[model samples]
Target: MQDPVVEYINRHPNAGWKADMNSRFSNYTVGQFKHLLGVLPTPKNVIEDVPVRAYPKGLKLPKQFDARKAWPQCSSVQDILDQGHCGSCWAFGAAEALSDRFCIHYNVNVTLSENDLVACCGFQCGDGCEGGYPLAAWQYFISSGVVTAECDPYFDDAGCQHPGCEPLYPTPQCQKQCKDLNQNWVDSKRYSATAYRIASKPYDIMTEVFTNGPVEVSFSVFEDFAHYKSGVYKYIKGDYMGGHAVKLIGWGTSDDGVDYWLVANSWNRSWGEDGLFKIARGTNECGIEEDVVAGMPSTKNLVVDSAVAAEQRASW
Candidate 1:
């Protein structure tokens, strides 16, 4: 049934990757896959851009780098999230990266809610589950800010009673109230001081991640990506599915000399190589090099509350 993905892999043994039907998306329609990929095309910038930080001359980037290994203290970068059946990858990506930066820059582990952005960002970010611009998600972070997931947990995987359990679920309502009866929204929100696109060059992207932390990126996802099982991935065969946003964790060269970008997907740990995949790097594979977005976490409207951190540390 999913022979095409395997056929392509078998024909290209040196393709540096393999595919299988482990995802159970074999029965998924093209529309279903496309709908889950939420990154929309880039529109005009509505936010501030920061100058790329300059590094020391003759700086040498490590041949291998992984955010999980580099910053083991920041647990947020190690978590693999599930976006479920929703087209909220853009929100998920932006929120995830901002959360990591909060831990890296501020030394606190706070998991920001994609639900807050997906439901509330509205036109500024774009349609919640239908699709959205990656840049707009970061812009929304600067303006409206987002709450902690503990305050506004994702609803997609909840029971059938909740609307999020339905297929192609309508966007959740933009409610500022927290799920916990005790917590309120206004005080729980976290802000970003700034947001911007990284220059599309490989060195520029690599340097940004290597210097600060992981960043959010949107890339073209093809059909064959759905069956990815293991190894450094390079698209071998498939129709264009849609744009997918993910957390760019690091970069490295495979033993075979293939340069790859280490990415953390929002599709849960079961979907790929333990909820992560390596895409061809330096080649702008699938437009991965384009539309990179990230932000510096801010404490302007909110603080990285210690009690909330205690709760997160317990739950996480």
Candidate 2:
């Protein structure tokens, strides 16, 4: 029997979109799909307090812009990362955005630790792996700062290689200390964001990505998205799961001339187009254009000496 998800995809007419059944999520049940995406509800209070930056009056934006192609040095336009079976997309999205922004600001390409935020940002960000809020995660970055992936690498289901390291999934105890499975520790002060901002309007969000780099965005995910292979996705039909967060890198038009937003997901290279996907633009499909959040890296002088000195000593 054909999988219902696959059947649905096969039946749907292509309206500038296509779905593939060969991907990993083809057979996942609605319940299972929902479990994999763990974006928590937007705390009304936090959203209300988050300051919005308005684009300067009448500033014209180019018809198209892609951070990856435009600022290749700062963009981590690499393979899609696998979050395993854990619900750490929220942490990954926020951390990845900060990583790219830091590179853009300082010309250094360092993979910031998503595990650090997942296991240490505390309850304020959301329960590690189980779920989290992107905004709260960014706020955590500003206040507590996270370290590099070299300091604390990500290991969702494939338990850490280090002998004494405990697996962190479903839910793990928050440990602010930065250490690898090998027990070696890195100073938390080495890498951390100093400030962040919220961009609610579509233009403001676009400007942030154009001037800065990628920004973290959360949006509603439906069952149909699991089979997304290529083309601009526009919510054909399916059960609305919770929310999923990703990094919005840029925007462009498809060969058919459909406007789309370029986004990077954490589902690894096996899913989507090499771990990247494009959604319809302008109309805010899936509420992606809403609730965008971004942050600035700490000043070089603030932690450069400490970070460089530590890197020199440990070669991280």
Candidate 3:
């Protein structure tokens, strides 16, 4: 019996297979040889910042969920193949966080290359997607600007071949070799967990964060996402445990009265109504109230187009 990683690599022809099960990955617990997967039970509800106070005025949020405006806006939640059923939520979380910030910082609304991060950012952090830190992933982006999601998408065991897509920024040989830039980007996009953990008001931090633009954050999907076959999911299973990489672009509730957190999922439009899903707010992922992490936008002097900046100020 070949190892899951090796077995996956064997079936695939071109993917650069790199795996280290021993490395500290995300929240999932892996048994011997992909036998069984485990997830960390939702920790006791610690007093964290409510998502209402942070929310920008007029922005609608899920009823049960919290953290409305905790961080900046992000793109959408994308579902990448878990890859041979490997639990590497930590890597996906980091990639998702960076993807949204990358788009906002550059003002581009394209998907980010999470696969590249999974394949490349190994030695620096845990390997095989078992565990990782959002902070460390941000640092890597500073040192290396990731490629557009168009260049590389997470391939399932079947593999991918999107045309004109290359993992590197410009050069083929230099793929994954990011441009060295000032680390200031890190400070600007940094999100603080403590802030969300200590808020009192019903602040919609997610709304406030998106007021500027979409930002990325990670969360555990409890077994709920697995059975999520369509319109407004509330019931979830306890057998599955995994960390999924998703983007949170905007929020809204449906007319059904089942308050939902409008999130853009990456499972391709086919999975959930145009790749969009409505999680039962706080129910999934230990009540969205506590799962707040911000991808702080860059605070560097806003480089406004001279024409646009002047006109905007005149109106003000």
Q: Among these predicted structures, which one has the highest TM-score? A: 1
In order of appearance, the predictions have TM-scores of 0.90, 0.84, 0.52
Q: Model 3: per-residue lDDT, tens digit, 1-316? A: 2145434433444322222222112223333222112122323332222232353367664444322243324333233323333333444555565445434444434454555555555544334334444334444454444454455545433222245532122111224432333323322232212112212122453554444333334455543344343455543333335444444555545566554555554434444545555654434433444444444323233343566545433532
- Model 2 TM: 0.84
lDDT of every predicted structure (CA atoms): 0.82, 0.73, 0.40
Cα distance off (Å), candidate 1, residue 266? 0.8
**What is the total number of backbone clashes in candidate 2?**
1
Ranked by TM-score, top first: 1, 2, 3
- Cα lDDT of model 1 by residue, 1-316, tens digit: 2577787785785778988776546556778778889888766555344444433446588999999999999989999998877899998888899999888776889899999988988888888989898888877888888999999998785412354345567889988899996988987888887777788888888888987799998888888888888888888888888899999999998888899999999877777899899999999998899778887777666556766545544531
What does candidate 2's lDDT look like per residue over 16-71, in tens digits?
Answer: 66777745564455665576687999677656666665577476777788777786
Better of 2 and 3 by TM-score: 2
